[model samples]
Target: MNWIDELTSTLGDSIHCDEACLLAHAGDKWFASHLPDAVLLASTTEQISEAMRIASKYNVPVTARGAGVGYVGGCVPSRGGLVISLAPMTRIIELNPADGIARVEAGCLTADIQDAAAELGWFYPPDPASRKESSIGGNIATNAGGPRCLKYGVTRNYVLGLTVVLADGRIVRCGGRTHKNKQGFDLVGLFCGSEGMLGIITEATLRIIPTPPARAAIQAFFPDFALAAKAVQDILQAGHLPAAMEITDAFTLEAARKHLGADAMPAGMQGHIIVEIDGQERAIKEELPSIMSILQSCGSINAMSATEPEDIERIWQLRREFSASLRATGLTKLNEDIVIPRSALVELVDFCSQLQQTHDIPIACFGHSGDGNIHSNIMIPLDAKGNERRAEAEALVHELFAWVLARGGSITGEHGIGIAKAPWFEGAIGSNAFELHQQIKSALDPLGILNPDKMGL
Candidate 1:
C-alpha cells in the first residue's frame, strides 16, 4: 500500500496522501517555495506512533511541524518527507499555580500559556516574538530563546520533560515535573534543541515563575551601534539584573519609528533599549540611575525610562514589533540570529557594520543585547525583477556567517539551523561535530525518517 493509503486507513480522512496539500508544507518563511511529499495530521499519540512506524517502514523522511511560525525555516521539510503537523493537538492539560508548572499538549500557543499564567499571578518568561502564534512544540524543538531569556533563560532551561513519539512509533516519556534529575543521560537537554530530529515531542512540562509586580522600561539613544553595544556591556557588569534588555541601532530604530509612526518610538531616541525591572519601588529607583549613568558614559544622545505602566507598555510595544518592521520597508528579509559571548558584542557589531559597508547592504541590528545575541539581519532590495539580487544577497549572507563563525559565534542563537543553515553546518560546527550529530540521528531513527534534510543531519 502507498504511504497515504496506510495513513488514511489507519487515521481516517484526517490523514492525507495528496501531493498538492503535502507540497504546501514544504517551505516556511526561510524558503517560501520549498515543499514536502506528504502531510499527516495526527490527533492522538497512537496515530503519530503509527505514522512514524509507516515512515520508518518505507524509509521515508518524517518531519514533525508546529504552527509554521518559525523564522529560520525550522519547520520547512526540505526533502520530500512525511510532515506530521501537531497543530491539531493544542490542549492545556493542567496548570498548577502552587507547583509553578504547566502540563500542556505540544501544539498549544506559547502566549496562551503566558495569559493563563498571568491570570494566576505566574509567568512563563520564554516568550519569542511570535509567542501568539508559535506552538510550544516548536519552541521545544528549537530550544527557543527570547528577549527575556537573559533573565529567565530559554525553553531548554524551563522544559522539564516531554512525551515523545520515536521514529519507529514507540511513545517514550523523558524528564519529570521536579527540579532535579540525576538519571543516565540528560534526555531533556538532548531533546530540547533536537530540532525534531530525535523524536516528535507530543507534550511538555513547563517551569513557571511568579509574575513580577512592577515592570519598567528604559530607552536610550546612542550615537553609534558600538555605543549601544557598550551600554549593554555596562548593564551586565552592574550588580542588578533587569528582567528584559534589548538593543536596536539607528537603522532599525528609525525603521521602527518610520513605518510604525512617532508613537512607535520612545519620545526621543536613535538607538534604543527596552528594559523591565522587577522588584521593590526602591530597587527600581536605584537601578535606573546606574543604568542612565552608563548610557551617558557610552555616548547616548538622550535617554528615557518609563516608570508608569502606560509608558512602559508603549516602549515595549516598539520592541515587540521590531521584527515585523522590515515587512513595512518592502525589503527582502533575512533575520540572521548570530550570538557571541558578552565580551564579543562590540566586536560582533563592528564586524557586522564593516561587512555591511563592504557589501553596500543595509541591516537592521537589534536583539537581546544583554545576552550578547544580536539579530544583525539584512534586507535585500525587493525591487530587483530578476533573481540576480537574490543570488547575490544569498552569497553575501554566507560571507556574513563565515565572519560570525570566525568570531567564535554560532550561525543561530534562538532559531535552530533548519534548512536555511543546514548547508553551513560544516562551517559552524566542523565535520567532527557533524559526525557526532549523525550518530545521534542514527541512534534515534535508524531508517532516517525524521526531519530528514533539516539541521543538516
Candidate 2:
C-alpha cells in the first residue's frame, strides 16, 4: 500500500493527511516549518507501539509530539515523515498520594498535572515557562525547567520511571517507583533528553513533593544589570533557597512596560528580579529583610516597591506575557537558551550588549537567574533589510553558543538541542559524546527511522 493507504488502514480516519493539517504538525518554536506526510493521533501506549513499528518498517521518520510548544524545534518534523501526536493519550494513570509519586501518560499537560497534584496538597516542581501549554512528554524529552528549578530541579530529577517504546517498537521500562537506584547504567537519564533520537516515550512515573504551607513573592528593581547581578549572588550566598528566581533587563522590561503598559512595573527601572520564597512565615519574614538588604546594598536607586497580591499577579502576568509580546514585534525571534555559572551571568549579559552594539541587533534578555539559565532573544527586523539581518542573527546565534561554551556553559539550558541546534552538536558535545549518542541510537534503532533527519544520528 502507499503511505496514506497503509497508514489509514491501521490508524483509520483518526489520521489527518490533508496538506493544511500536515502543515500544522510540521515545525515548532525555532525551526522553519515543513510539510509532514501525515499526522496520527495516538491514544495509548499500544497505539504508539503500533505506529512506531509500522513507521520503522516503512523507513519513515516518526517525530513524537506532545503539545509542540518546544522552543528548540525538537518536536518539529524536519523530514516529511509521520508526526505521531500524543495529545489524546493524556491520562493520569495513577496518583500515589501516599508515596508522593504519580504515573501519567506522556501527553498530559505539565501544568495540569501540577494543578491536579496541588489540589491534593502535593506538588510537581519541574515547571517549564510554557507549563500552561507544554506537555509532560515534551518536558521529559527536553528535561524542561523554569524559575522554580532554582531549588526543586528539572524534569529528569523528578521522573522516577518511564514507559518508553524503542525505535524498533520494543517496550523497555527503566527505573521504578523508588528514590534510589544504582542500576546497570543511568539509561533513564540518557533517554530523558535524547530528543526522540533514542526512543519514543509512551508514559512516565514522576516524583512529587509536598506543597508548602505559604508562599511569598519578592520584586527587586535595579538601576543597572550589574547591581541586579550582585543582588542575585548575595541572595544565594545568604543561604536562603527560593522556589523561583527570575531576571529581566531593560529591553525586556521595555517590552513588558509597553506590552503590559506603565502600570506593570515602574517605568524608569532598568532591571527587575522577581523571586518567590516559600516556607514558614517566620523564615520568610526573616529572609525577606535580607533579600531586601542585598538588593539595596547592590545599589537600589529607591526603596524597592512592594507587590500587592494583585500587583504580584500583575507582574507575573507581565513576565508570562513576554513570549507572546515578542511575537507581536513583526519578526521571527531566534531564542537562544544559554546557561552560564552565576558568576558569569554579568559577563554574558554584558557580552550580549556588546553583541548588539557590534552587530546592530535588538535582543531581549531575561531568564531563571537563580538557576543561571537565560533566554537571549535576538529580534530580526521587519524592514526590507530583514532577510540580510536575519542572516547575521543566525550566524551570531551559533557564535553566542560558542561564547557560552567557552565560559563553561551549555548551548541549551532548559530547552533540548533538537533539530535547531543539531548542526552545532559537534562544537558543543565534541566527537566523543556525539559518537556515544550515535552508538545509543544504533542500539535503539538499527534502521535509524525515528526523528531521523532532525536530531542527527
Candidate 3:
C-alpha cells in the first residue's frame, strides 16, 4: 500500500486523504498555499508520535498545524507529505491556581484559556489579535506577542514547561509546573520560537497571574505621528508602564474615517494612541489623569479617557479595526511586524513616511508602540484586471527590510520567519548563529522529515 493507505491503516479514521482535507490543511492566513498528500486530524499526543514515527519510516516530510490563523506561512505544508493537525486536541487538562499554572493541550484556543482563567480570577496575558481563532500551541511556536506584551512580556515568558514530540516520535517532557527551572539547557526555550522545525509541541504548562481588579484606557489624537511617538516615550519616561500602548498612523486614520464613516474619529486626525492601565481601582484612577496630562503636553489635539468596561472596549474596538480599515481601501495590504528600539520610534515612522513618498505607496503604521513592534503595511493598488500588484509590493518589502536591518531593527517581532522572511533569516541572525541553527536541526531531525523547508532550513 502507498503512504496514504499506510497512514490510514495505522492511524485509522483520523487519517484523511481526500482533496478537501488536503486543501483545507494546505495553508493559513498567508498568501502561499500548497496541498499535502495526506492530513491527519490529531486528537492526542500518542497519535502525533505514532504518525511521526510512520513518516520517519517512510522518509516523508511532516508538517504540524494548529488553528491555521498565522499571518506568516508558518504552518503551510510546502512539501507534499503529511500534515498533522492538532486542532482536535482542544483540552485544558488542568488549571491550578494553587500552583499558578494552567496545563493545556496543543490545540486549545488562546481565548478559551484566557476566559477560563478569568473565571477563576487568574489572567493569561498573551492577547494576540487572533486569540479567538489562534491556538495556544501556534502562539508558542511563533513566540507570539501583542499590545499587552509591552509590559506583561511575550508568550515565551509565560511558558514554564512543554510536552514535545521529537522528530523520531519520542515524547519528551521539558521543564515542569515550577515557576523556575534551571536543570539543564533551556530545551523548552529552544522549541518556543522554533516554528515547528525543532519538534512538535503536544502540551504546555503556562504561568498565569492574578486578575487585576480594575482597568482603564485613554484614547488620544495627535496632529502628527512624531508627537504620538513622543507621547509614547514621554509616558514611559514619566515612570509609568502601561499594560498596552498602541499607536496608529494618519493613513490608517483616514482609511478608518472613509470606511467606518467620517464620525469614526476627529477629522484630519493624523495620529492616534491608545493607552491601557490595570491595577487596583484607586491606582488606575490616580494614574489616568497624569497620563492624560502627558498626552496633552505632547501635543494631543483631543483625548478621551475611560474607566468603564464597555467604554474601554469601545476604544479597543477601533484599535482592532485598523487592519480591516486598511483592507477596505481596495489595496493589497502587505503587513510587516517589525521592531525597533523604543528610542527609535520616531525615526522608524519617519523612515516609513519617506519610503511611502519615494515609492508612491500608501503605508499605514500601527501596533504596540511601547515595545516598538509596529505593523507597517504597504498598500498596493490592483491592476486593471483586479490582480494584486504583488511584484512591486514585494520589491518594496525588500527595501523596507533592508532599511530595518540597517537601523538595527528586527524584520519580525511577533510573526516567525517563515517563507516570507526566509531569504533574510540567515543574514539577520548572522553566519555563526545560522550555523548553530543547522547543527541543532540536524541533531534533532537527522532524517529531516519534520516541517521541512521552513525558516530556510
Candidate 4:
C-alpha cells in the first residue's frame, strides 16, 4: 500500500494530506519553507503512537511540530515526510496547588498554562517573549529561556516529568510528578533540549512556585552603552537579583523612536537598561530606590519607576516593541541570540559597532543583558541588492559566531540549533562531543526519521 494509504488506514481522519495542511505544516516563524508529504493532526498519545508506527514501518521521516512559533526554524520539516502536529492535543490535565505541579499536554500554550497557574495563585516562571503564541512542547524542545531566566531559570528547571514517544512507535515515561527524582537516568533533561532528534514529547508535568506579593521595575537611560553595561554589574554586585534585566543599544533606541513616535523612548538616550524586582511590597519599595540610585551613579541621564502591575506592563510593552521597530525600518533582521561572559558585555557591544561599520550594515543590539544573552540583529534591506546583501549578511554571521566562540561564548543562547544554525553545530560542540551526540541520535532514532536535517545530526 502507498504511504498515504497506510497512514490513513491507521490514523483515519486524523491524517490530512491536503495542500493547505501540507503548506501550513511546512515552515515556522523562520524564513525557510519546505512542504511535507502529509500532516498528522493527532490529538491523543495513542493516535501519535499509531501514526509513528505506520511511518516507521514505511521508513518515512516524521517531524514533530508544536505551535510553529520558533525563531530558529526548529519545527520546519526539512525532509518531505509526515509532519506530526501536536497543536490539537492542548489540554490542561491537572493543576495541583498543594503538590505544586501542573500536568499538561505538549500542545498547551505557555501563556495559557501561566494564566491557569495564576488563577490558582501559583506561578510558572519561564516567560519567553513568544509565550503568548509558543507551545509548551515547543518551549521544552528548545529548552527556552526568557528574560526572567536570569533569576527563575529556564524551561528545563521546571519540567519534573515527561511522556515521550520514541522513533519506532514505542512509548516511555521518564521522571515523575514528585519534586525530586533520581531514577535510572536524567532522560528528562536529555529530551528537553534534544531538538526533536531523539523522540516526540506527548505530555509534561511542570513545577510551579507561589506567586510573589508585589513587583516593581525601573527603566534607566544612559549616556552611552558602556555605562549601561556597568549598571548591570553594579546592580548584581550590590547583591540585588532582579526578576528581569534588559539592555538596548542606541540604534534600537533610535529605531523605536522613529517607529513608535518621538515619545516612544526617553529623549536623547543612547543606552537603556530595565531592571525588575518582585517580592513583598515593603521589600520592593526598599529595593527600587537603591537600584535607581545605582543607575544614577553609573551616569544615567534619566530614570523612571513603575510600581503598579499595569504600569510595569506598560514599561515592558515598550521594550517588547524593539523587534517590531527594527522590522519597521524596512530591513530583514537576522536576529542572533549569542551569549558571552558578563565581563564581555561591553566588549561585545563595541565589537558589534566595529562589525557594523566594517560591513556597512545596520546592527541593533538588545535583550537579556543580565545573563549575557543579547539579541544582536543585523538589519539588511533585502529589497535592494538582494543576492549581494544576503551573501554579505551570511559572511557577517559567520564572523560573529567565530568571534563569540573564540571568547568562550555560545553561538545560540535560547534558540536551538535548528536548520539556521546547523552549519555551525559541529564546530560549536567540537568533534568529540559531536560524535557522542551522533551516537545518542543513532541509538534513539536508528531510522533517522525524526527531524533528520537538524542540529547537523
lDDT of each: 0.81, 0.81, 0.91, 0.91
Q: After superposition, which runs of candidate 3 have C-alpha atoms over 4 Å from their true positions?
A: 384-386
lDDT of 2 by residue, 186-265 (tens): 87898798887788888899998888776677776788888888888888898988888888888877776677778666
Error of 4 at 113 (Å): 0.2
Quality of model 4 by C-alpha lDDT? 0.91
Alpha carbon deviation, residue 167, candidate 3 (Å)? 0.5
| Cα RMSD of predicted structure 4 | 1.2
Which model, 1 or 4, shows the larger lDDT? Answer: 4
Model 4 stretches with alpha carbons more than 4 Å out:
382-388
The total number of steric clashes, by the backbone 3 Å criterion, in model 4 comes to 0
TM-scores of all predicted structures: 0.93, 0.94, 0.98, 0.98
Tens digits of per-residue lDDT, candidate 3, 1-457, equal 7777788998999999889899999999999999999999998899889888888888899888999998889888898899999999999999999999999998999999999999999999999998999999999999999889988999999999999999989999999999999999999999898999989999999999999999999999999888998999999999999999999988999999899997788889889999999999999989999999999999997699999999999999998788889998988888899988888888888888888887777789998999889999999887789887788778888888888888888999999898888988998889999999999999999998888888899
- Candidate 1 stretches greater than 4 Å from native: 18-20, 32-34, 260-270, 382-388
lDDT by residue (tens digit), candidate 1, 110-164: 9999999899888899978889998999999999988888888899999887899
- When summed lDDT is taken over every stretch of 10 residues in candidate 1, the lowest stretch is 382-391
In Å, residue 182's CA in model 1 sits off its true spot by: 1.4
Question: In order, what is each prediction's RMSD in angstroms?
Answer: 2.4, 2.2, 1.1, 1.2
Model 2: residues with Cα > 4 Å off, grouped in runs: 2-6, 260-268, 301-311, 321-331, 383-388
